[model samples]
Target: MFGRLRAWSRRHSKLVDALVVSPLVLFCLLTLDVYKSGPPFGRYIGIPATLVLSAALITPLLWRRNRPREVFAVVALVCFAQWVADVTLLPADFAVMIAMYGVAARCTARWAVAAGLVAEFGLLLAVLRWDFSQLDAFPSMSVFVIAIWLAGIYANTRRRYVESLVERAERAERERDQQARIAAAAERARIARELHDVVAHNVSVMVVQADGAGFAIDSDPEQARRAVQAISTTGRQALAEMRRLVGVLRQDAAGGEEYAPQPGVAQLGDLVRQVSDSGLPIGFTVSGTPCALPEGEQLAIYRIVQEALTNTLKHGGPGVRAEVDVHYGRGEIVLRVADDGRGASAPWVEGGHGLVGMRERASMYGGTVEAAPRTGGGFQVVARIPVGVAA
Candidate 1:
């Protein structure tokens, strides 16, 4: 409830100030009789004069927050005028102090100090004009001015500190959000590469099988039937791979379909076997211990191998023999895909997504990929990825 009131007061500051000053306004109205004194000695300033001056002193307070320095000056002038006319309203004196507080709380230090000095001067004038008997009241009034001044300064300091902290927190939140956006963009790029490798490899095989079937349709019915079966199998594999890529995009939605697990080191043998079945003579070998790897890195390794083999199929010409070798060392895994086919003469353009994707995937895992024409023979791709030792 207190929090709500504070929030409301902040929204309607002028109304809150008016409500606070209501009691003082009532006190001034009730105490007009206090100014009822005879002539010669008392100089009775009439009710009209007292009311106008009191209004001048207190009303400016409503705008104190917006224009505190100007409000203080107006209130100070009215205070001096009341003292000169020998008509003292106690509420008017309080208004001067309140005006000074507004200045000290909102204005700069120089202005606040100037206001404090002006107020102190007004205190002296007040003591001399009104209280010849109670001279001790001057010291007490001076203390009140000093205390209110200090309180205003403290409040100003604390407010600035809070504002700075809020600004810092906002800045940090913006940076975190920016980082998340950059990471998400990178993740999308990786998925795109995955889709490219999967589609390219599978479609290339299907196209090869379709061409073979067309040639053998009238000559050999058995060969044609086998080619058609291969095409159907390749198409199904392509669809499954596409579903995996699309699954990442829909994972955030409700009732998302379960997706096939991403291909990893364990899936490499099956991958090689599929390519071999597609009429590519390929040898697959794994040496040393196979340890656990992060899913992303495993995906990287899988795509690198797949892209390398795809490139070989597309460019290695006829009668090419390809080999995939995975060697797990003490704290690193090495992959080498080499094919003895038409090497440097093949139209494998540089800067294409095939080799570039492999490099990007390896670099993401603090690894490296090198693809080039092998010495005295065909093309080779070597990738090295550092990993934790198997426990």
Candidate 2:
């Protein structure tokens, strides 16, 4: 029953405070006349008048509970007035105790200490002035003073606990949001890398076929028709793969089933043929015995080669001779593509999307790529992939 009431009071705090304080004020006002009627200053109307004034002063405090400094100031003023009125007025001094607790919890520690000191000293002076020679009053008054100081201490401790809980909750929320952002950024980077490899490889092949068709159209009709057919087939294959890759961005759950088998090492011969038809004088040589590899490793090797040849075709000048050498071994596979062409004027010039894509693919397979101008002439790209390693 008490817990329910406490929860209800929290939900309707303004209503609860009004109901509690309004009746207490009225009762205190009615009893003030009785306390002051038999005083030393008999029939001195000042005592009842002060009580009435105190109640009026504290009524505003209910509305300003969160403004602890303001509430403390007003309640302290009322306590001073009651102290001057008579020691009998001490029973109505509970308002000052409540305000002291609020000051400790919401305001600075210095303010809480100052308020406690002022109230204790004023009460002691009031008792001495009244000359009440009752030993029983001392114990009760001491208990009341101790309770007020303890309430202030408890308020300060509780406030610290509440603030700590709030700080921890905010920190947890920030970390959750940061992790979500990191995952989204990583996904976008993967998509961009895949698109770069797909577009670069397919577009380079198409450009070569179109050039071949143009040259053969006037000299040999049969060869021109074959080149056109190759261009059409390459374009269609690229379109289908692009659709599969782009489907990754779709939100529909059913769209996830559209994934097609991606190219792997088995397609290396096909990749070589496409490059050969592109008009650059090229040769492909295989060393060591061939063996099967994991699907991911195969795909990685294919992308690395595709990116290297694309770079060669774009940057390697006319009549350039390019060589692709694949060495399949026991524990690793080494692939190299080198071009004897006009090397870049600034050898240290940064690479573009193709180079970055190649590096990313090689890294995915626990491998590395080295692309630089050769000592004799032109540029060389070497990639090595470790096979059958513990994942």
Candidate 3:
């Protein structure tokens, strides 16, 4: 019940203050003439009236307690003035309590401490001048006032500390979430690179074999059968690797089925044969001896060629011829795939994932891939991959 009332009072602060203070103001006014009956200035009817009015005005200021400095300054000033005037009929301590709580809750620790000191000093002066020796009084009033002031300072400090802790926790949680998102994005890009290597390598081979099988179906039955067999094997290999790549999405706590090896540079011949069988008339030429490369570098080379061949099969018209040349040198390897298709008459469409993936692959190896229209009426893709040393 008390908690509910306190919440409601907080919500309707202005109304509650008015309701509580208006009656007290009226009571003080009624007793003012009796309390000041001794002297001319005491009986000067406006003095008590002014004090009562000042106390009542403090209620409106208290309504703005959330704005601590403004409300504290106004209330403290009014209470001090009332104390100086010896206005006992109205309890100015009520205003002092509100100002103290406001300072403790909303103001900085330094300000709260300063306000508490001033209030305690003023209270000591008032007590010293007033005749309270006959009254039931505690001998430790100074100690009690000092303790309350210290308690307000401690409470303000603790509140700030708790708020700081909560801010830090929120900041840490946000940073953790941001890092998780970045990791997930990196994982997705890695998967894309892997998928491109697998699909491009196998699909080029299948398309070539399928084309060869179609051409020999009527002229040479035996060769057609061989082409068909190659297609089936290449298709199965592509499908199996595809399934392995896709299986990455499935969660496996025991770390099962994730240790599959990826394709690299050694499989370039298989890729070349697949493109040759597709019937686009591709010539493979290698200038230097084949050497082993890092798995990532090998995958990059494979993807660059795959994207080039896919573009050829899609855009290179009938009677067009394509050539793939690889030059393995002392420090780096240069792979170039060009197609002599119908040139400027068919403008190539721009902005596709194939081109972007090719570029990213080359960039990972600190290399460059350039795809542009050849001056001799063909499209050429020249990619260079640095190897055997840091770039």
Candidate 4:
């Protein structure tokens, strides 16, 4: 309830202030007969003159927050007029100190100090004009004025400090959320590349093996059984790889699926054999001595090769011939896949998701891939992947 009230008060602060101050102003006007002797103006007009001056002094406070400097100047002029005419200090006289506090709290330091100095002068005039017989009242009034000024300066400084702290905290939170979003996007892309490699290659092999099994069921019973068995093996492998990828998506560390090891360059021969079963002949060659590499880099090379082969199978015309070449250098590994077919569209030029995925994977390990049409009549994919000694 208190929190709600504070919010509402902030929204209608000027109205609230007027409600509180209006009564005090009325009281000051009611007690206007406190002083009997003053300049000719006060004596000639009597209570009406005192009431008018008191209202003028207090009414300007309603706009103190919105126009603090103007309010203070106007209040100060009325105060100086009252002092010169020897008007007695009333509760409405407190408006001058209130105006000074507003100026201090809402404006800069130089203005606050100026307002404080002006308020000090008014304090002296108020002390002389007020009907206080005790000498101690003089020192006490001065202390009260100084305390009010100090409070305003402190409030302003503290408000600015808290605002800065809140801004910094909000900025840090935004950056943290942005980083989380970027990491999630990167992980999703990685899983997508893995899923494509697993399903496309394995499903393609299963389809080919099923076709072979159908062809040989009556002509060669033994070849038909072997084809069916190969299909089973490929299906099981695909399921396991899929489980691992799914486990990664769920972030389930306890799941055994995610713990499975990823395949590397050593699996290339098997990959080649499976792809060739679709009636496309492909060649595999290694030009230099091999070296072990990080799991991430190895995965990148494997996926790039897999995507290239899949593209060839999909777009290469009938009776396509493909070749894969790998070279191990002192500090880098290079892979090249070339196909002799009329129908394969160059990925870099044509623009496809598979080629984009390959590039994203290679860039993670600081490598590069180029896919374009071969000069004569085919498609070629070449990648240069830097390496570190296997850990």
Deviating ranges (above 4 Å) for candidate 4: 1-74, 77-91, 109-151, 207-225, 251-259, 277-280, 287-292, 343-349, 389-391
lDDT of 2 by residue, 50-128 (tens): 5666665567558545677788788777667655754345335667766766676666678777877766776676667
Pick by TM-score: 3 or 4, better one: 4
Ranking by lDDT: 1, 4, 2, 3
C-alpha RMSD by candidate, in order: 4.0, 4.7, 7.2, 5.3
The 10 consecutive residues of candidate 1 with the worst lDDT sum are 35-44
Candidate 4: tens digits of C-alpha lDDT, residues 1-391 = 9769978988998998798687887777676665555532223346776678778989999998788899999999988987787665656778998899898988899999999999987776565555355546767878998999999999889878977897999999999999999999888878988998788777776876788799999999998998898899889989999987887767446744326788888888878887776556889999778877777888889889998888887667667899999999877788999998863453344567788888988888888999888888998899988887421
Clashes per model (N, Cα, C within 3 A): 0, 0, 3, 0
lDDT of each: 0.86, 0.75, 0.72, 0.81
Misplaced by over 4 Å in model 2 are 1-20, 40-48, 81-91, 108-123, 130-167, 253-256, 265-269, 280-301, 325-335, 345-351, 360-369, 383-391
Model 4 scores worst on lDDT over the 10 consecutive residues at 36-45
Please report how far candidate 1 places residue 257 from its true position, in Å: 5.9
Which candidate ranks first by lDDT, i.e. highest?
Answer: 1
Question: What lDDT tens digits, residue by residue, belong to model 1 across residues 314-372?
Answer: 99988899999999988889999999999999998999988888999888878899989
TM-score list, all predictions: 0.80, 0.77, 0.67, 0.74
lDDT of 2 at 199: 86
Candidates 1 and 3 compared by lDDT, better number: 1
Judged by whole-model lDDT over C-alpha atoms, candidate 1 comes out at 0.86
